[model samples]
Target chain A: MTEKIVVAYDGSENAHDAVNFALSIAKAAGADLIVAHVLEWSPYSFLTKTEVEERHKRRKEELERADKAIVSPLLQEIQSSGVNVEVMVKYGHIAETLLAIVKDTGASQLILGRTGQSSLTSRLFGSVAGSLAQVAPVPVTIVP
Target chain B: MYNKIKAPVLGALASCALAAPAAASNIDEAVNEVFANSTGWFVNFIFSPFPGTTFPWIVAWLVVAATIFTVYFGLIQLRGFKHSIELVRGDYSDPNDAGEVSHFQALATALSGTVGLGNIAGVAVAVGIGGPGATFWMILAGLMGMASKFTECTLGVKYRNEYADGTVSGGPMYYITKGFAERGLPGGKPLAILFAIFCILGSFGGGNMFQANQAHAQLTNVFGDFPGWITGVVFATIVFLVIVGGLKSIASVTEKVVPFMGVLYVGTALIIIAMNADKIGWAFGQIFDGAFTGLGVAGGLAGALIQGFKRAAFSNEAGVGSAAIAHSAVRTSEPVTEGYVSLLEPFIDTVVICTMTALVIIITGQLVIDPATGLYVLNESGSIQTVGGNSGVALTSAAFSSAFGWFRYVLVVAVLLFAFSTMISWSYYGLKAWTFLFGENKVSDLSFKLIFCLFVWIGAAASLGPVIDFSDASIFAMAVVNIIGLYFLMPIVKRELTSYNARRKTGEIKKFK
Candidate 1:
């Protein structure tokens, strides 16, 4: 059976590196690769329901582009190596989405960039990662 | 037994009265007397400053100017609200760009500068004088301020100067001159000079002295009978340590301190609100009523609105051009991106944090009005005192204490942390302004740091009333120069916005990495 590995993706170079690292690990373990991206909802965007739907559509397009740019290449490379791969794009806050995906997928391992799309300060993950580490159902590795 | 008890009780009362003879001469009463005496002097100063009923006239002009600008710019602040979220999300962040810090760090540093005493003491002063109605005007001012922050920060990045050492310098001075010069406009150089002057003065008073004074006061109050000199010396040492290290150090410290203190303070407030959830409705009602009632202690609605707007303007400094100095250092190549992040500042500082403070104060019935005197009685003294008289801090502390009695100590820690962070940020701002006037030589930098440190000591040691009032005036005076620059340079902002939007639409812009 293929071991399942989840990679946190936010389109940053560091995050891309982590995904590449995850894919490499998944290929070594003969595992399926899951790519996840997190989105934060801001209160300032007080758009109407119709406007929100439009915004979501636009965001989805953007996400798709990111997938094309980052995830697709990795998937191709991993599949070429004769490994099973599955893409999971989850949307929500980074930390919560990450922990939830890990639990639901029951993945044996998780991979994340040291810093994602967020600024360097927030990437410390002392609060986000520390909390996740405490309760995460699986072992998580942070790739710097 | 009854006689003996009565005698001792009476003796105790007499002793208390004797011990606090100066208490009868309350601080509020003294302040009121000073105000009454200064009424004539103020009247003369206002009238003589290009004459005919200056206070109301200036106010009328400010209202008209703000209204016209809001209309003329098509309420850019509203548009900025949308962009600000995008900025924080790193939508416009470009790592390959030439700058010192990331957009988020720049915003955090700028916020650390603007969001200090203004949120705490400024709000207190507004609510105390203008009653709850001040909050409404404060919100209005903050909304209008979005355009101001957007304009200044965009210009800041656009006109930034890259030094040989990879350092960047930009603000109103750069924009007023460079932007106007590029557009072939007249008097750009002069306007830039004027803006620089106001900015320098503002840095010394509002940014430097004001922060120090409040920190000193809060520390002394918490640590009873502690010498003011001790407060000054310790704070000055800390300020010197961080500020002398320049923007990199300031960014590092603020990036950590801002989020931690912000979350801690906001979290404490949330706990208080949850505990007093039942009073939330009444608090909102009072805020609305006090805002429009036109029955303030002095000039009624107009007075309240003026005070509220003034406080909010002073607090967030959305248009003051100071934040641009910090935002200019953002690593992003896109100026509008930093502008978007800058927009969040007012929302966080005024809309969220300030609102939390106002609700806590109002819900606790601290803004009590004496029917007989039409004055706010903020404390048990029965004398009408404005909330800024330690009462504001005390009231907030009381609210926290009510929810988590031990949390007041946490608040003290938070305040000190906030105060220290603010001081460091402002020191950098002043240094930049100082460098602009003087050369950027090491001696010039050292001299500015020394003077800034001295003021820190003075602020820590002195009574808050005079220094705070002066600082408030100095900070507000920056608006006079900044708003003018913004008014002239707004077309540039619009052009940049259009181009940015076009790029976003065409899918040329990639998602933030």
Candidate 2:
């Protein structure tokens, strides 16, 4: 049985480094690598009735494009490396969605990178890796 | 009981501060001079009295519109009042619906813009000029204006434009243009341009300056005669910081502060009213008497009616079409639902809060009715002399301080907060109108905001008369163009209302919670 490991990816340079760090560990342990990307979403806005109605369409197109543009290319590279791999995209706060995917996939471990935005934004929104480390169901490895 | 404890305490302070300052006299003069000049002839033309009566035809314009909307909608304000409450409470709200704010939030935001100084000071002015009788007509107008709000806001949502970037803009401008195109009518573009022009001007006058002017008056009353320009500078800086951040900062502050301040203002008025519980009957009697006979007030029935309708229009802003812009941003699939939610605005603002201010003034004996003449007392200089010695917010401050003695301090804080928040919100409204005219570029945005901030200072330093006259005229000008568009768009609103009502009867508009 291949042990499950989930990599929280955001398509950043540091996130790519974390993916490589996770790959070596996954290869060593012969585990399935599940790459997850959580989009940051805050719905409170001042919009007109029409803008809001069309937001549904815009949100759908954005999610589809994220998969086609960001996740699909990565999925091909990982699968070609001859390791069991899959990609997941969820829309919500980053840390919470990553943990949710971990529990749903029954992954034994979580891996992600320390984004360059760790200064003020992480302090304000709470850093993804910092949050996952605190309450993640599995052990969290944050590649610096 | 406190009379025994307070007699000597009052005597001790009376001797300590027996003289008043000379700057106090100059402050009022300078402000009044600027006010008269700023408003000038344009306002005089708009407010010019009718040939046979003292009432301005502008008053008749709003009253007639409110009455027509009431009749055409089959008293929809009354019919939909209950559903309106439910809509605001989010009974029919869908989480998946495309909206930036909830119905309650939209109403609260819109209410903040209308409810501020107009409720506190404008009511005092109306009662001062027209006597307590004006309150009767004011209440009637508020009730009628509910129907007008229902008409304009409903159409505001139905004809809104949803841009490709998931941003939306709606108002009389959008509906005037689009609704006309749909009906295959001409002159929509010109009407839309006219509405935008007036909307921008109205934003500067009533929505910005009047608020700043009154807030400064309240502050100067408590803090002594600092240059009005100094107060203007302080207020302008705060407004700049907020509006410069765009909608994000405005949205955050208005959502929290608007409702709290509104409740605080109403709560204070209720306490004053309750304290004078004995005078409630007399107040009501005075209002009724004044409404019909005018009790020998200068212009009699015509005077009271004119001031009542004019102030109520300024206070609640039903037909001026500004509320439609605020209401259009609510999250709801049904446009009529927003209309229902918006009608509560005038009710809370004019019918409830405004009436409370009028009651406090009357109950506190602030109007000074003359027993011999059965009219307001005339000054030694042969001018109308109000009980508080002046009109506007000063009259209201006197009314409140008569009861609490220290309530002026509380009122200054309230007025300042009200003025600052109003400036920030009106900046967004003005920007929307500005961009509609000047294209939505960075330079256009900066220039409009710069002009808006400068007006904030000008408003604070100016006198009550000119600021108010200009504000009233500019806001009324918006109604001239907007109401014309609304006349053409009412059939569309009727069709939408009928369809929504039929669907609501079958539970197609389901309650999620």
Candidate 3:
């Protein structure tokens, strides 16, 4: 069985670099490349009863929007590489969801973008890469 | 009997009573009479005097509720105490969770209302009339009240509603209606409506009027006597400014203010207790001795028990369902976690803060305890005056001042801040209920606020008896409806609790911290 590589894609320029890096890593290792997109979501627990209903509607719209606007096109563009690839889109903490996917898919390595968030924000919140590096079950490669 | 009222104020009140009786007096007294008489029906029914004792059976309602919950939940208040701390510390909080505030903030806002005059004056009054033994019962009731708080807040969060604007509405109203609907039970709407009415009335009475009334009392003590309406106007203006219109952002700022005043008040109690460290044991001895014996008061043990439970119920308001409004806004997926966190409120308000106030009063020896009769000596005016011959805030003032002369000034500020913040919180609480009853619109909202402000003026300028009576009546009345709802919805809460407990045990509920 071929080893698997996971790419954390968000449609940002650095995400393109990450997909390319994962694609190359998959080729060199003769592995399958899995593109994973995490749509940011809150727990939705704060919403009022009325808001909760509307939030569900918005959340569906958001999932569809994320797939159509970013994930679908990105997956199609990457498919031209002609390597065996799969795409997964989910919602939750970006790094956590990506890590979970890596574990579930038995991926050997994970590649994500560096500095998608603003410098000040990443400094304050800590970079997602910085966090996943410490917790990921598999090795993480943050492509700049 | 009327000595606490100044002679001049008495003259003025008498004149107002005399002048109003013919024309406006009948209408005023009659309206008061209707509410006074009718609410009493409900009040008397709930608080019927216990047979062979002066204590009301209604106080037993909360006591029983607390006890049943304590046992039913396997003493969750104790078992969950450590987790309560962790939950509050944000160990289980996910920032992305749907909530308008954090655990600490919601607790602070709710605490802002509860940790006010009740801790300062209500405790003093209980100890004075019920003796130190009242302190024992008060502590017991507060501990037990924790379980009541847990049950209500869990239901509160479970039944809360989140709106599209990211604002959430919770508390007893939502729980009563939604919980019942979910359970396929009837009477949820009517019970919710009754609770809203009492809540709004309570907001106007205890939250608005009583606050201004006491603030005026303390103001006069510090700054010398001025017409209370003047202080009322100042307080009303501040309340209106903070409560109405924009700058709605001050809520977060005010949340911090409550804990500050609480710490200040509790810190003062600690210092005084330390100064009289030797008296600490003696104070506890008095408390224990008095509790069972009622210290020779009219009702004895029963009387002390009554006063303790009644005042603790009044102060912490654990079962009254107000704190659920605040706690429901907390950012946690597990509603039961909010329950665990909110139970800490009564523990802090009554058990810690109120107990400190009680201990300070006891250790300071400010209470004029009559050893011969085991009764507290009434002031020269033949009125109930415990601290330095002044009841209410003055009594608490005297207890603190006995240790540090300057502490009274601090006490005065603390009282004022406590009263002020309590009014602010109650304004929001009342507005929520008002909107629930009268439709949430600018007109109803403004009108309710306008009426609330008017009461601030009326509260300052009026006598304490009727206002405080209404306050006590309405607040306790809220308990009547709220406790009823709690009974119906408790099974649902149990389901939530059991599920959360199982998930927590299995580590499915991961702690971020």
True contacts kept of each: 0.00, 0.02, 0.02
Off by over 4 Å in 3: A1-144, B1-48, B95-100, B249-252, B371-375, B378-387
The digit string of per-residue lDDT tens for model 1 on B23-51 reads 54353345334533543343333223335
lDDT at residue B319 of model 1 (Cα atoms)? 71
Highest-scoring model, DockQ: 2
**Candidate 2: segments with Cα more than 4 A from true spot:** A1-144, B1-35, B98-100, B245-251, B372-374, B380-385
Q: Which candidate is the best by TM-score?
A: 2
Pull out the clashing pairs in model 2.
A52-B98, B31-B463, B35-B466, B133-B290, B133-B291
| Better candidate by DockQ, 1 or 2 | 2
In the range A9-124, model 2's lDDT, one tens digit per residue, is: 87888888898899999999999899998777544333332233345456667778888888887777777667788888776657767887898889999999997874888889
Q: Would you list the C-alpha lDDT of every candidate in the order shown?
A: 0.66, 0.80, 0.77
Better of 1 and 3 by DockQ: 3
Q: Candidate 2: how many backbone clashes?
A: 5
Q: What's model 2's overall lDDT? A: 0.80
TM-score of each: 0.69, 0.76, 0.74
Docking class of 3: incorrect
